[model samples]
Target: MAEQDWDSQTVIRKRGNVARVARTDSEINSARRAGVSIETQRKVTGNKADPGVHYQRIAKVDYADDVVPPPKLNNSVPQAIQSARQAKQMTQKELAQKINEKPTVIGEYETGKAIPNPKILGKLERALGVKLRGKDIGKPLFAKKDGK
Candidate 1:
């Protein structure tokens, strides 16, 4: 294969698309070890002028009052599961392989009406590399009690 010019090549980083030229798997691992999520503003090449270079994550998320609950979103649990899976770069087959299950199980998992068990949750956490509990996603933030 012919060598591509470094300047012309747009090296897309995996996991989170942070810009880095000719990044290896080691670099990606190192970056992850350094906690390079979308949370803190970290420079890739130390170019302050570049918005794409110094991107930051939002800490506090706002919950809109008008927002509908999860049951209203897509088909429910599976949709959230599906979205989170995609965000973590996991295909159903890949996730299934990690959980030591067949690909068909994963398909059922993403579309079935059955509530996910702890074993399945464990697989999901490992596969997506994120927590599945709490304000995980796709659920509305409920109003607090007034303590009347």
Candidate 2:
């Protein structure tokens, strides 16, 4: 008889006569218990066991059939700034004037292509009555052993 193709689950035996079992993690485990060499190959001289699953599956699925979605995130600080200015019933020119800055400065802060200076941030907060520091000060630490 032709030798069977080897899969992860294909079983091999040490001799011509032995009980056939569907190869499995538990079967390998039992072999471990009964003093079978975990890494050694031995000569077998008889009928092959039927092909079957090896590992005990927690669950199984066809991964090729999944429809995964791309991740979503926010880049909305600029839009938030614009909307807040609008809610305060101010134009770009008016906002700039109230903050004692240029309209282009306000535009840059709103678009997020530039970071606001401390003075500008303070003026914007005071003028617009909104806090722009969404930076979390109270989040839990996942610090390393050195507490870095």
Candidate 3:
């Protein structure tokens, strides 16, 4: 007999398998004794959204007026800076330019209002050839050696 090809034909699935159970006498007795429905209960996996502990945040405030001011240069230091610049026949602006600083900074130092910054002081010392720090404030930075 010749085999027929089933691949070319359209197939239809009419229904799925159903079990019409006939309960045994023992099962029926047990169900009757328990008097409970056959439905299963839902399980809890403890994967819950928790609104966790909240802590109070601390706020930090800075009182600008309450802050201790930066230390100012000594009166002698300012006086030394001024006298050295004047002796060199240089204005505040000219000295500031020579030291690569603002004219206001030079003015402040001359007026005893500026803070003593080591870097600026060094620059001023080199530019003006004066000792602006220590006890000998207005002394020359490099002392004259004996004539060779």
Candidate 4:
């Protein structure tokens, strides 16, 4: 079989075992007005029975006021951990066992050679009955501007 010539104007053409369909300008415009990018529109509308079905655009939200900032870790973590453990009269091995962590991990955290993630830090806080994580204090440095 002879191969068919393909061009932008070709809407439904078969070339050997493969077929192609070109998109109309109105279809492209409809996709754009629906808030779908050109690239994504191809995939979304590829298998749809009616591509004209409108898609509601999701509104973007600012979460700065909704969520609390995570606690900041500092050099004092090592000292804090060590002091709390000593105050409780708990050995490194004992503290590690309580937190289900290795003794060497506890040692490293106390020596300031390693930092614990939030989960591990929470465990340490619970075990030592001390707040290793810093509290969120003070206002943000920048002020929000009102629309002029």
| TM-score against truth, every candidate | 0.36, 0.39, 0.53, 0.43
lDDT: the better of candidates 1 and 3: 3
- Candidate 1 lDDT by residue in tens digits, 1-113: 99978777665865885566425678767778888652344445444676573333321222344567433222555776787778768888888888898887778767854
TM-score pick, better of 1 and 3: 3
Let me know the TM-score candidate 1 reaches against the reference structure.
Answer: 0.36
TM-score of 4: 0.43
Q: Specify the poorest-scoring 10-residue window by lDDT in model 3.
A: 51-60
In model 2, which residue pairs have backbone atoms overlapping below 3 Å?
none
Off by over 4 Å in 4: 1-73, 136-148
- Candidate 3 per-residue lDDT, tens place, 1-148, comes to 9998877966597666553343576875676587744443344333334223222221123344357988989878888888888898999989988889999999898998888899999999999999888868889999999996
lDDT for each residue of candidate 4 in 1-148, tens digit (9 for 90 to 100):
9876675375486658432232888887876787764553345433377556533321123344467755445777888888878888999999999999999989888886774587988788878777777652121223368878
The residue pairs that clash in candidate 1, if any, are none
Off by over 4 Å in 2: 1-74, 136-148
Tens-place lDDT per residue, model 2, 1-148, is 9888676574575477555553678988988899875663444333235224432231234454575854321255566667778887999899999989999988877877665477876677677766555552112122236655
How many Å off is the CA of 61 in candidate 1? 52
What clash count goes with each model?
A: 0, 0, 0, 0
lDDT of 1 at 10: 66
- Ten residues in a row with the worst lDDT in model 2? 135-144
